[model samples]
Target: SVEGSTGLIASLFNGIKVTQSTMSEVMALIDSSNTKLEYSSQELSNASKKLSESSNLQAVSLEETAAAIEEIASTIKQSSANAQKMTTHAQSVTKANEVGKNLAHQTVKSMDELSNEVNSILEAITVIDQIAFQTNILSLNAAVEAATAGEAGKGFAVVAAEVRNLATRSADAAKEIKAIVESATQKANMSKEVTDKMLQGYNALDDNINQTIGLIEEVANATKEQQNAIVQINDTVNSLDKATQENASLASNISVMAQNTQELVEQLKNAVSNTTYNELSKKRICDPALIFTANKLKSDHIVFKDNNFNNCGIGKNFTVKTHNECDLGKWINAHKNEKFAQTQAWNELLKVHEDVHAKVQKTVDLYAVGASNEEIFTYTKDVEQSATKVFALLDKLREINCENKS
Candidate 1:
């Protein structure tokens, strides 16, 4: 009984030591994990903040674009309306020109009729002149015969001479009327020529007006089509703006959640730290190298060196250089005075880098669930690719800065 009792006591003591050691390591690991979680949350918060800011900028751009589209649409509509008005005016002018040509033709016809009437009047005047002349000649002959019968024929001769004088005056009056009629006929013929020319001019004007109307109508139709297309584009832009707004709201929510996660991780770190208060005297500064170990069981993110990124985390027989992770803290501190941080496109790229980091962080959980080695490799490759994109984006921002200075 003494021997058995002694054996049982020793086994119990050994089991307690093992449990204490396991708990101690668990506490340390939890503290380290808490650090990584805090960093991840802050990174997520920053990324969400950037994403929200980008969304705001995009919304503003969309609003301005929509306004510009509205202005253009207004201008286009005005132009189309003016075109329509011009078309109406052109049609009216064409109709009026047609009327004018008809009037001109009628005027030419009237002028011709007037000329015919004038010619008839001239012919009547000529006939009058001939009759008057014949009358004068007959009266003169009578007067001569009366003179030959003298004394007894004296009164007859006087009457015959008076008749001859009257005929002579009448013939002179007829000639004067005939001369006036000839002048009237000449003027009427000239008027007919001018009226004919006016008719031709009116006809030509009508044809030109018709052609102008056709061209204006075509322009109006084309302008209408352009306006319709622009309206559709405006609608699409509005939809995009709405989507961007929704995205901004989502980013804001993510930022809040990140902040909450950081708080929770801090609490967990404190609770674990409290469990090992007696161990603080022996505690060394946190093993920063341990944070970069390729083992996801200990760390959550890929460790990218200062300048080189191709060899992410670590490989077999690989040694780690003592450097900060991603240089993000330095990058962020330097960004305070850097104009690139304020750039919309640059901030967007930053968000993209953070999003990729988030996806890569998910691999830690996957590894805990016994994910396949191939699956892990695939995720790691994606992280590298995303890191390359981030570097390229930074280069682009530098390019923009250089160009601006130049």
Candidate 2:
């Protein structure tokens, strides 16, 4: 029994090397996990930062789009109203045209009546012309008979001559009146043709106005549909924006948890060391779930108390208690100076981005060449500067869009 107890003690005492070896493996595993967590957290933070920038840009673009749509809708409404007025005026003109057509018809009728009266006058002139010819012949026969009767026939001859002369003058006067009446009738016929053409022109004009009115009504209907579609798009963007903010928050939380887990693993590695590892099984167990943590994400609230932005004017002034969305033209007009400034700042900021990329590449190369942590720290300032520039651009964008606060 004593020999068996001594043997058991020897076996237990010799197991320390095996125990230390197993603990070394555990420490290696913990080191690997910590490395993964650090890399992932850094990547997450970078992505979240970019996403925040994208979300803000989307907000600015969406607000601009919405303001543009509202202005378009207003313009359409005004144009539609003007078209309605034009339609009313066209109807009035059509009525007046009809009245003019009636007057033209009356003029044509009067001309026809005048032409008929002229024809009657021409007929009377023809009768007088024939009578004058007969009278002249009869006068010639009486003159010859008077010459045969000498002195007794002289008085009869003079009387017959005077009668012939009076007939000739009557025929001449009738011929002149016939020529004048024929010319007047021809002019009246031309006048009727002109009046008829005027009536046709009026009818064509009325038709054109009716077609124009129909087109205006169609445009008004289309504008209404576009307004509805834009509203739907705005609602969708807002919902997506909220979801994006939630994901960013979750990423931040994961980063904190990873840092804590790395610290715990460090302690656990020390506990397994041969220097003081006799308390082996007394250590508190870690939850396996910590190795694969995932977080539930949430959105950022819009109406937070510190929701203030700098004024660079694209919409109404943020400081104003009440303001309406501005038109595209007005928004552009408001942001001209700011836009110019942004462009200049962006050029400088772009260099910062390039500089950061070069610095990071150099830092990686230095690490490979056995650079110390203190050496790596020197390059960190360049990264921080890049971050600062990005934030500055973001803040500038915020100020530009603040004027359009919903």
Candidate 3:
């Protein structure tokens, strides 16, 4: 009877175990249905938000495209006007060149006549020099004769000597006049050469002007071509503007699609969150302690300081180095090449050095005018801290940017 009771109890325990397993299976199915419903709702909400942002971006793009088309139109009009003005100026330059060439030719002819006159004067002066040479010889002979004839011939010799002296004076005057004539002749010749060269240059310039006029004509043709090209560009930009509008519309559609995808993913995420498996996955996916440690490592201590740079002209009543003779010396010696060394020295010593010193003196005076040291120190500290924070922020931003890129 005891053995029979034990068998009945075992059968009852097996039935209870089967009933508990069936109930667990039913609960899993209900949870899965709930997850699917939640995911669908979330996906719809995300899709709506994305569509709104995409629409706004498309509107902005359309406006920008229209503005760009208008700008192109204005540029084309301005370019056409400038091209016309250039063409007119080129024509005027051609006419002016022709007139200049004519004037240069007339100037050359006048210079040739002047040169002929100078040559004639030089020939007469040469003849005078030859006569003066003969006179000098005759004067020396008279002086000798006056010495040979003594006493009674002395009076007559004195007259001869006086005549000789008169001749000598005439010869000297002739020589001076010859020198002046030669100088004038040389100058005239030089002038003639210069004018002739100028005439040649003018002729060359005329030829070049003609060639340049041809080039200008070509440029005018090119300008017309450019004008036509600009017109085509305007048309192309208009077309591109229309295309951009279309692209924006397409982008809007793509954005909507992407939003819907995001929403679906979000729903899936929510659905997964509700599962025990998801909870285990989240713990495995991220370590909060590691994240906190990284954040702390990235943080920096910021400090500020401000001072009146009475000597440097940088800020308030800070006694900056007014005369940095050492800096000047260093700057002077900084140049490797000897030629640039002096220049570097002057640049450093004469330019900013003086100005900075002036500024420093001004700052000191400003601080002396009823400003307390504590107040000045506080201000200076504030300024320094502000600069430090700005640099720190910049560094942090760069790190974040680098991380994003990676």
TM-score of every model? 0.58, 0.49, 0.36
Residues 349-389 of candidate 2 have per-residue lDDT tens digits of 44554554455445555545666767655664444444345
Sort by TM-score, top down from the best: 1, 2, 3
RMSD of each: 19.7, 28.6, 38.8
| 125-182 per-residue lDDT for model 3 (tens digits) | 6776677667667767766776777676677677776767776677677778768867
Measured by TM-score, the strongest candidate is 1
Query: lDDT of candidate 3 vs native?
Result: 0.51
TM-score of 2: 0.49
Locate the minimum summed-lDDT window of 10 residues in model 2. Answer: 294-303
Q: Write the per-residue lDDT of candidate 1 for residues 1-406, one digit (tens) a residue.
A: 1222212242333334334434554466577678889999999999999999999999999999999999999999999999999998988888888888888888888888888888788788778778878888888888888888988878988888888888888888888887887888788788888888888888788778888988998899999999999999999999999999999999999999998998899889779766763243123214433222212211122333211223333232233322123454345445546664577757766676675555455444445556786776566555455544554454455445545544
Ten-residue region with minimum lDDT total, candidate 3: 297-306
What clash count goes with each model?
Answer: 0, 1, 15
lDDT of 1 at 149: 90
lDDT of each: 0.67, 0.54, 0.51
Higher-ranked by lDDT: 2 or 3 = 2
